[model samples]
Target: MKKKTFNVLLLSVLLSAFTIACTKDIDFNQIDDFEVTPVIESSLIFLDEPANQFLEDGVEISSVQDSVLVEIFKDAFIKEHLVKAEFVFETTNSINRGIELRIDFLTDSNIQLHSFSFAVEASSTNTPTIFNYTEVFENNTLESLFETGKLLFTLNLKPGPVINENTPGSIKLKSKGIFFLNIDNTL
Candidate 1:
C-alpha cells in the first residue's frame, strides 16, 4: 500500500509541473510603421511682389503663406498601438541667419494642440542642419484628434531677433520631413 501511494503522489507532481511549464510560453507583439513627406516652398518665403501673395480661386492659401497646413494619415496611424512618433526635418540650407521655424499640430477648429520651434543663426554659412522634433500628445490628445479627423500640421517662418531689420536676407530654406511611428499589434 505504501509503494502504491508513493507512485500516485509522484505521478501527480510530475503532471502538475508539466502543465505549469507548458503554460509559460512566450508572448510576441506586432508592430506597424507609417511614413510621409510634406511639401513647403522655401523660395516663396518673404516674396516682395504682391502677385506672389495672392493665390487663384479654389486654391488653398496655406501653400503660399508663411504657414503651411499638413494633412495627416488618418487611416494607417491609429492611437491604440502607438508606441512612439517623431518628425524629422532636414535641409542643406540651414545657415545661421536668425530664422525661426515653428511647427504645430492643430485641431479642426484651428486650436493649437502642440508646437515647437527651431532657430537658425545668421553666422551659419550654408551648413547642413537638421531638426528632429518629437511630440507625444497627452491625455488622449492624438486619440481624440484621430477620431474627429481634425489633426493638422502648421509650419510658420519667423525672423529671429538678431535678423537685420534694414535688409533681411531672403531665406530659401527647402526642407523635408519624415514621420516615424511605432504601432502595436493593431497592424
Candidate 2:
C-alpha cells in the first residue's frame, strides 16, 4: 500500500509539471520592431531649352517704297511682331506708292498668328516674290528679347525719296532661324 501511494504521488507531480510546460507555445521570433516596414524616398527641374519654336513668320516685307517704308517695315518686321496689328495695303490708282500687303501676327506662345503675309518689292515692278519673311522683333532703346535666340529683323528697301539710281529698290528679310542684325535699339 505504502509503495503504491508513493508511486501515485510521484506520477501526479510529474504530470503537473509536464502540463505547465506544454501550455506556453510563444516564440514571437524575438520581434523588437515586429516586421512590416515599408518606407522609400528618392527625388529634379529647370528649363529654358526652347532653342526655337516661335518663328511662325518673322520677316515679312516683300518690299515697300514709301510711307516711311510703312514705318520702316513697321520698325523692321511688324513692330516687333506686336500683340496687335492688321493692315491690308492695296493701292493702284496709279501706284503713287502703296501696293497690297497683308499682316496678321501676334506671336509668343500666346499664339495669334497662324500664317501672316507681307510683300511689296515693286519699287518700279519686277518682284513676283522672294524676300521671305515672318514678323516680330524686339530691342527698342535696349533690352529686347523675342526669345533672342535668333529671329533677325530689318527690311530697309528705299526708293522713297523717289531716287532713280536703280529705283527698283527691292525689299528683303527672310527668317526661320539665326539673328543679331543691325544692333541699334532705335536709339
Candidate 3:
C-alpha cells in the first residue's frame, strides 16, 4: 500500500510538470502582409463648383486668383456686374493684383458707339505711380489718374499689357461725368 501511494504521488507530480511545460506565452510585433493604391475620379458629373480661375499677362489663368468672373466672360460682361482682372508678374514691379473695372454700355436709342471711353482713377490703395501718357495725364505723378467723366479706365482691353510708359494707361473717356449717350427716340 505504501509503494502504491508513492507511485500515485509521483505520477501526479509528473503529470503536473508535463502540463506546465506544455503551457506557453507568445508575442508578436509584425504584420504578415499589406497593400496600397491610389484613387482617381474622372466622371464629369459634379454640381456647380468654383473654377480655379486666375489671370496672367501670358500664362495659365489658374496661377492668378480664385473665382474670377471677368476672365471667363469679358466681351459679354454686363453693366453693374463686378469682376476681377488677373496679373502674373515675375518681376519687381508687379501691378497684376486687384485691378477692378466697372463696365457701362450706352445705346443710341439704347446703344452707345462701338468705341466708348473710360477713366482710371488711382485708388487710395498702394497703386504704383503711373508715368507719362497725354499732356493731360503726364508728369508721371497721377495724383488723380486718370480722370474722365463717363467711365473708369476704359479703352479696348483685349489680351496682354493694357498700358506702358508711353501710353500711361490712358483713361479713354468723355469729359462729362456721364459717358454713355442715352439716345432718345425723339429724332
Candidate 4:
C-alpha cells in the first residue's frame, strides 16, 4: 500500500508539469495597418426637353436602344487589400416624373461585377424627392473588387411621363463610395 501511494503522487506531479510546458502565449502581430480611401462622389442629370441630356464628357447615351453609360470613377480604388466597402446612392427627382434606375459596377475590362436597381418617386411640386441605398462588402469578397483595377458605372433610366408638358421635370442622381483597406503582414 505504501509503494502504490508513492507511485500515484509521482505520476500526478509529472502530468502537471507536462501540461504546463505545452501551453504557449498567443501572438496577434499578423495584422499590420488599416487605411481608408477618400470618398468618391458623382451625379448625373436627365432632362426631357433636351431629350439627350447625357451628352457631356464621361457620359454616353444610346438613343437607338435607350441606354446611358456614365463612368463614375476612373481608377478610384488604391492598390491594397480591401477590408470593407460602403456605397451610398442618392437620387433626387425634381422632374415631376418617376424613373426606374439600374446601376452596374464594371471592372477595367468592362466585365460587370455586380448590379443594383432602385426606383425614384416623381416630384410633382418641384421639390426634390430623395432616396438612399447602402451596401457593404467584407473579407475575401472585397479583396476581389480591388483586383479589378478601375471601376465603371453603367446607368439605365426608364422614365415615366411628365405631369405637365409645359413644365417638364428632370432627374438627378448622386452616388458616393468609400473603401477601407488593410495591409496584411501575411500579404
Candidate 5:
C-alpha cells in the first residue's frame, strides 16, 4: 500500500512540473518569409553505338542524329522556380575516328533555342579517348532553357580510316542535366 501511494505521488509531481514549463507563442506570420533553393540532377542521355552502326551498305555515314522530347520545361511551376541549369557531357571513343557532337534545344515548333558543339579526339589504339564538356545556363540563357521542348544530338564522324562492319570499336556518350530552383512561400 505504501509503495503504491509513493508512485502515485511521484506521477502527480511530474505531471505538474511539465504543465508549469513556459512556452512562447508561435508567430505564424514567419512562414511567409520561408524560401527554399533546391538542385535537381537528372540523366539526360546515354548512347553506346558500335562502329558498324555508322556504316550503311559499305558506306560510312557522315552523321547520326537523335532527339529526345523534354517535357519537364512544360510545367509552369518548374518554369517559375527555375533559376539556372547546367549540362555535362562525357564521351568515350574507342573507334579510330574523331567525332563532333552537336546539341540543340528546340521549341515545340522546331525552332532552335540554343545550340552547342564539342569535339572528341580520335583514339589511336584500341584504348578509349575521353572528352568532358559542360554548358551552363544562367541570366539570359536560363529563359531559353525553360522554353526547350526537345533536345537534338548529332554525331558527325571526322575523316579517318575507313570504318567497316568489322570495325573493332564503339563510341559511348553519357550526359546529365542539373537544375537549380528557388522557391518562396508567402501568404
Candidate 6:
C-alpha cells in the first residue's frame, strides 16, 4: 500500500510540472517580411526541318516563318511577380547552307514590340554545327515582355549548295525560356 501511494504522488508531480511549463511569446507579424524569389524554366520552341523543306519545285525557299502564342503572360499574377526573363536558343545545322533567324515579339493585335536576329554557320561535313544564343528581358524590357502575346520566328537560308528532295542533312532548332519571379507577402 505504501508503494502504490508513492507512485500516485510521482505521477501527480510530473503532470503538474507539464501543465505549468512556460513558453515565449510568438510574433505573428514576422510573416509580413517574408519574401521568396523563384526561378522557372520552360521549353518555348522547337523545330526540325529537313533540307528538302527549304526547296519547293526545284526552287529554294528563302525564308520560312511561324508563330506561337505566349500563354503564360496572360496571367495577371505572373506579370506582377515576374521580374526578369531569359530566352535560350540552340540550333544545329547539318545542311550545307548558313541560316539567319529573326524573332519578333508581338501583341494580341499583331503589333510588334521587339525584334532580334542571330545567324548560324553552315556545316561543311556530315557532323552538325551548333549555335547558341540568349536573350534577356529586365527593367524597361520587362514591361514590354508582359505585353507580349505571341512570338514570330523566321528562318532565312543563305545561298550555298542547292538542296533537293534527296538531300542528306537537316536543320534542327531547340529553345527555352527562364523566368525570374519575386513574391513578397508585404506587397
- Which candidate number would show the highest lDDT if scored against the true structure? 5
Cα lDDT of model 1 by residue, 32-72, tens digit: 33433332222212223221222345331323324544445
What TM-score should be assigned to candidate 3? Answer: 0.16
Compared with the true structure, the alpha-carbon lDDT of candidate 2 equals: 0.32
lDDT of each: 0.43, 0.32, 0.27, 0.55, 0.92, 0.90
lDDT for each residue of candidate 6 in 62-163, tens digit (9 for 90 to 100): 899999998787688998899999999999999888999999999999899999999999887847999999999998998778889999999999888877
Residue 182 displacement (Å), model 2: 44
Q: Higher-lDDT candidate among 1 and 6?
A: 6
Local accuracy of candidate 3 as per-residue lDDT tens digits, 9-108: 9999999999888655554422323222222212211112111122144333422211111222222221112121111111111233223232322232
Q: How accurate is candidate 6 locally (lDDT)?
A: 0.90
Superposed model 6: Cα runs more than 4 Å off: 1-25
Pairs with steric clashes in candidate 5: none
Weakest 10 consecutive residues, lDDT, candidate 6? 160-169
Candidate 5 lowest-lDDT run of ten? 178-187
> What TM-score does candidate 6 reach?
0.84
RMSD of each: 13.8, 25.9, 25.7, 14.0, 2.8, 4.5
Cα lDDT of model 2 by residue, 1-187, tens digit: 9999999999999999988875666787556434332222111011111111111244333342221111123354423333322222222211113334443232333233233345444433433333333343334421233222222122233233332323333322222222333322332
Task: Rank by TM-score, highest first.
Answer: 5, 6, 4, 1, 2, 3
How many clashing residue pairs, candidate 1? 5
Error of 3 at 146 (Å): 24
From the highest lDDT down, the ranking of the candidates is 5, 6, 4, 1, 2, 3
Off by over 4 Å in 3: 1-105, 113-115, 118-158, 161-187
lDDT for each residue of candidate 5 in 31-135, tens digit (9 for 90 to 100): 889999999999999999999999888898989999999989879898788898899999999999999999999998999999999999988795899999999
When 2 and 4 are scored with TM-score, the better candidate is: 4
